[model samples]
Target: MTRAKVLLIGLIVLALGGVGYLGFEALGVRGFSAGIAAQSLLVLIVVVWTGSYLFRVVTGQMTYMNQRRRYREVYDAKEREDLEARFDALPEEEQQALLQRLGLDGDDVRADS
Candidate 1:
């Protein structure tokens, strides 16, 4: 999820929890809020932090994608160069024989054979 979405969701959950805890404490049911508005501010701080964390993760993923694409281009170029080097080393007669066997000399190699 996006940073904004994460922050919104976290804030919602924190608000619900705080309200539930407050209600519980008032009813003498045992709870965790400490009964202070300032304490609830922690929820906002954490939500903002989590939002920044999520944004960093998204940017890191994009960076990885760009690095991977660059590596692929380099690898493909090397492979093509290697294949050309090997092909060029072959005798002209062998190269012609290979082309003929590949059916490149005729549309109907089987009929000709």
Candidate 2:
């Protein structure tokens, strides 16, 4: 695995272990009834955080797309049109290849046209 991915997984494991330990300590010191509640709360918080992190991971591409759109929005209309025009000036095959790399090319958008 990649170093970054290995690091991330290691951190996640450590976080889970720390939380579990804390929950167990709270249960032992607080007595059965209160400990159950504390543990429940801890588990709930971890679940929510993990779920949020997973959601962000799953939507990472969409997040990038939103950022790109926002970046384009920062340009004035004339500048945006000029940028588009420059892009359009590229040869059709190159344009299609670029779009394909971005996973955005469709069959209808022929490279030969």
Candidate 3:
């Protein structure tokens, strides 16, 4: 993570801690109990956030995984195009021979199909 992100997160946590403390105080909790309650609230929030992230990962909904999937699709498409171009550049007799060697009929080798 970047330094700025770390600093921002630290500030957020501090703010949440203050809010938690004030909330518990408003409920008549004081001193050590209020401090503990605030800390527990923070821990609960962190646990829920982490759990949601894990759920996204396990369900294959993560942005990083999506990006990698898109990259693979584009790379495979380019590779397929390159292969077709190379095959098209071959002499007619060589193309026929290749089809024969591969046991693929000329009419059945359309890439889109």
Candidate 4:
């Protein structure tokens, strides 16, 4: 992701590792075993977190995706409005001709309605 996010994750991992190591040592596990235990704890935590995030995404529970979808809908609506305005600006004969060419009834496509 971003550099800042990477740095923050690194810091969080380091902190977790340190806490895990100390916690294991306090429980009478020392040296290499403590280090391994701490590392394993970190791996487990990361795996669980990643799985949770993936589940949310797969279920469409991610807020970012929802926001993007909403933005796209709004953008599409604005584009449609702009196109309709341009079509309305065309001269009456041209508008009628365009509707006939497109097989649309002029009365049904009027902007005033």
Candidate 5:
């Protein structure tokens, strides 16, 4: 329901109207008696309009999902940083015990030495 989505929907409606008018004109439908050609054109317009609307809906959902994922990533990173800082502030014995419990012994890896 954003302004851009509204504008796009309006544009699509206008395009469908224009195409329907042209179809009617091309079919030479002068009077109230519409033929199969006009009906087929109407169907085509409906199909195209529906497709455009669905596309907008799908893209909007995807954008929302992506935004949510990014926000979660940022939030999780902040939380992790806070947790790491708290862990680092603990005594060495407590830190070592916690790391061992988590299967991350400090003495298990030594690349600089």
Candidate 6:
């Protein structure tokens, strides 16, 4: 697993451990007993919930970051030029439709430059 995934798992573990400690209080666990069994079950629920969310959240973040990175890597002058070249080859009517779809045909659209 990636570092981010590992970190998320570690966070989930710590959260679960905290929940377990809380349960131990409810179950009347003392210093010698350490953990209360009944409360420990509740702790399992917390661990499952948090771990599932952590897995999904961290994975989603990583996927999004990777996608953006890929887009940046592939988005450059050549791609723009290629798109423009293709657009330029189209007839006026088709080009107008394309530009409209791209929001590039707006009459009032102009840079502040």
- RMSD each, Å: 11.2, 11.5, 2.2, 3.4, 5.3, 8.5
Give me the displacement of residue 71 in model 3, in angstroms. 0.5
Worst 10 residues of 6 by lDDT: 104-113
- lDDT, model 4, position 97: 90
User: What lDDT does the true structure give each of the candidates?
Assistant: 0.70, 0.71, 0.93, 0.93, 0.73, 0.69
Per residue, candidate 1 scores C-alpha lDDT tens digits across 4-69 of 997997788778667756776776755343455435655676679789878867877556677897
Q: Write the per-residue lDDT of candidate 2 for residues 1-113, one digit (tens) a residue.
A: 58999899779766765666667776575556455655666679778978997888787745667888778787666696796687689998888887888787755444433
lDDT for model 5, on a 0 to 1 scale?
0.73
Ten consecutive residues with minimal summed lDDT in candidate 5? 30-39
Ranking by TM-score: 3, 4, 5, 1, 2, 6
Residue 5 in model 1: shift from native, Å? 22
Range of the 10 consecutive residues with the lowest summed lDDT in candidate 3 = 104-113
- For model 5, the stretches where C-alpha displacement exceeds 4 angstroms are 2-15, 18-61, 107-113
Number of clashes found in candidate 5: 0
- Candidate 5 has what TM-score? 0.53
* Stretches of candidate 4 exceeding 4 Å from the true structure: 28-33, 56-68, 107-113
lDDT of 3 by residue, 1-113 (tens): 68999899889988999999999999999999999999999999889989999999999999889999999999999999999999999998999899999998778787544
Clashes of 4: 0
Task: Candidate 3: list runs displaced more than 4 Å.
Answer: none
lDDT for model 1, on a 0 to 1 scale?
A: 0.70
TM-score of each: 0.39, 0.34, 0.80, 0.71, 0.53, 0.30
What is the Å distance of residue 81 in model 2 from its true position? 2.6
lDDT of 4 by residue, 1-113 (tens): 68999999989999999999999999999999999999999999999999999999899989888999899999999998998899889998988899899988877776544
For model 2, the stretches where C-alpha displacement exceeds 4 angstroms are 1-30, 61-65, 73-79, 83-113
Candidate 5: C-alpha RMSD after superposition: 5.3
Candidate 4, lDDT over the whole model: 0.93
